[model samples]
Target: MLDLRSFLEVCKKEGELLELRDVDWDVELGTLTELLAEKGGPALLFDKFKDYPEGFRVATDMYTTVKRFALAIDMPPDTNGLEIIKKWRAVDFEPVKPVEVATGPVMENVDEGEDVNLLKFPVPRFHERDGGRYMGTGVAIIIRDPDEGWVNVGVQRVMLHDERTLGLYISPGKHNAIIREKYWSKGESCPVVMDFGPTPLLFLSAASHVAWGISEMEWAGYLAKEPLEVIAGKVTGLPVPANSEIAIEGEYLPPDVESRKEGPLGEWTGYYGGGERSEPVVHVKAVYHRDNPILAGTPPIKPPNYAFAVQVRTTPLLWNELEKAGIRGIRGVWEHGAGGGRMLTIISLKQEYGGHAMRAALTAAGSHAAGYMSKLVIVVDEDIDPTNTNEVLWAVVSRANFEDSVSIIKGCWGTRLDPALPPEKREKGDLTHSVMIINACRPFYWKDRFPPVNRASEELRKKVIEKWVNEIPLLRG
Candidate 1:
């Protein structure tokens, strides 16, 4: 419901935002962000860099908490992850096309030709081992399909190459990469517009796995229940969010025409998984920004701490996919942040018949949402909460049979970011990996005879807590 600036104001009002002055951009700012995110700290608004002018700022950890994420999508700040998921799933996905405007705040300051300089802002190096300063960690790279004429706004890591150039790296098989390749096949540079500070909903849409041909901008608008304002880029003629902080109009040259080394930067997988490699470069033609631009940063740090505090969007997609595949009795679905969200998934379901858990496990292993880069899929009984790692592990150890409960799905969809992917396979461009599905439910045949959990019944526990909560203050929680 709110734009980027207004969203920050809301966060500030909720005491979820912190403004830091004069932090070093090279590593200090990034290190601070990492530490804060690991501790579930507030969103950081960094200003007054050593070499950059004041008001030229970088904001990080904006969605590193469920409340912040909920606020971003116009939900009540107190909404939990599952509630957010259910709310999202209830939405109708009809595209709400962005309305084009002649000009807006982003046009307040413009730089083109020789005047375009990217270093005016404080671009963080993010990691000690990073190859270069990155400006697109929390960016939306807009490109259109040449043949279909459909637009796509997707998130990809961008490394600053020079004053008027950027190194772009889209993961293999992604919609953006697919569309770019279509242009390359025609021997033409792909027109591009990079939005450094898109609205939170737009950023979420860019980072999501929206189906091909469906514009992310429209999807974002549909989610917001309104149309986003857009302006055509002066050079690329591509749509840019009129209210965004900074935008770069450019073209991604075909790899054969122009390329540069990218990555060795820290990834969400907690590893420099892609390493340094040659990638296509975007030759910036025009740059536009508001008077005091705010660049959003979502640089990936180690596991258990991701760009988003919770993987809110994808979990629902996975759940819907499971349901669509006819897997019933699914009580909960959770993608763990420890494995960069996608590598490990837990599903809790009510076991109705023999092999029901196994069926759900196999289906989840290949489902559209959980199919990629997935390492493990664990199926647990309804008694176990999928979000509680300890409870899920207890179910696995207590109920699973090694010979029958475990099954490996080899050569499933994966990515180069998989740290466990062998060097040999990576070199050969074999990005596929395996997934292990563990059915952790009690044996269906004799579930009635299986050992019962020692925990008290829910009715007794609730009644006792309600009766003695004031006396035993700890029970109040």
Candidate 2:
């Protein structure tokens, strides 16, 4: 609850911290993380890398599991994905505003100008085909809107360009990109502070879409139920988390003067869609860190687990938007967990009128909070569990008239990282794409003629589980 360091301490106490000593940094450090993550391993804290000193360490898999993710937001360890987001949506965030601090752990050691060397930290080559060791994953890039004066924080993939420079991949619609353009339009270099490994919640809140103009720090305060501690950055003048593990303050040089080649790192979509390209460069002006800093490495490794916590935000966000839109009979909403909580979403509703299911589907697909990049949006009756793919699919195949139910709206907001996108269109910055909205709910005209579910009821299932408790191990949960 205090900082990333405090969260790691809690993880250590709960036996969620996996300490690995004296590992190789080149590819070995990241390889181990990927292998352990695939096996559903614990949070990794690597100390004494082959080329780095004992104090310079790296950590991975911070939110790889539900237990770890719940800890990130101070929730119960066993809280599932849907529950986590729902609880977050229920919090009363009444502008807890950031409290300024004199000094903290992140500023313990400071380097300015040519003295700043990013290579001091243990940057890892996360995958076998990676272009180089990256310093951007699991990091929060802090920038304030030049006009609005409100801050924007985004967790973007950063490439370590050199000893004094770094490159970042800011998606087209992200606030950071918009804010940077505002600075660039004035023909001035945009100052930024790269906040690294302060807190997992800090990263989560920063990366989320809280409403426009509201700072992510305010949202973090909402999650912590207390004002977040921030300090004036030494160079950038932006607010940096008081207890962050590392801070890299720099100016985003105009692309005309300098640019850095970035990419090929696997993104949260579990694929490398964009590949390599030239991106804006952040010339390092100052560096700050705690003594023997732990660089948090949250690179998107293989499929599935990396995006669980990332996707949780979307579930509640979409649900709340629907309620705000005055759409009634909304029973539940779920982002298919295995889809990394991004592409596939399902909405369950009690059909109150004709076209209700299609209406819900269209609303979800067009949502700004959670609709972007959604590949398939399925709407089902309240009887179906949106979180359960098997139930949703059964409803789809059984209830839907294939030709009438499927609706594809072309040029809808999409992501550049979508692997299915054509290379030429991606290069041209055409992020919009078609989304398939499927209404799997039973036809309103059928009324009482609709076929009843053949499966046993939940009461009967619970009764069976209670009666056969001794014989069925899987039913214990």
Q: How far is each candidate from the true structure, as Cα RMSD in Å? A: 2.0, 2.3
Off by over 4 Å in 1: 307-310, 459-477
Q: Score residue 387 of candidate 1 by CA lDDT.
A: 91
- List candidate 2 segments past 4 Å from native: 456-477
lDDT of each: 0.88, 0.83
Candidate 2, residues 1-477: lDDT per residue as tens digits?
468878888899999999989888788888888888888889999898777778888889888888998988888787787678777674455666888999888889999997989998888888877888889788998899988889888888889888998997887777888889988888899999898776777788877767678787888887888877888987888888888899888999878878878888877788887688788899999988999898888888655766677577778778877877767888888888666776788999999899887877888887856776888999999988887879999999999998988888898877777889987888788878888988899988785699888889999999999999889888898
The lDDT of model 1 is: 0.88
Model 1 CA RMSD to the hidden true structure, in angstroms: 2.0
Worst 10 residues of 2 by lDDT: 87-96
lDDT, model 2: 0.83
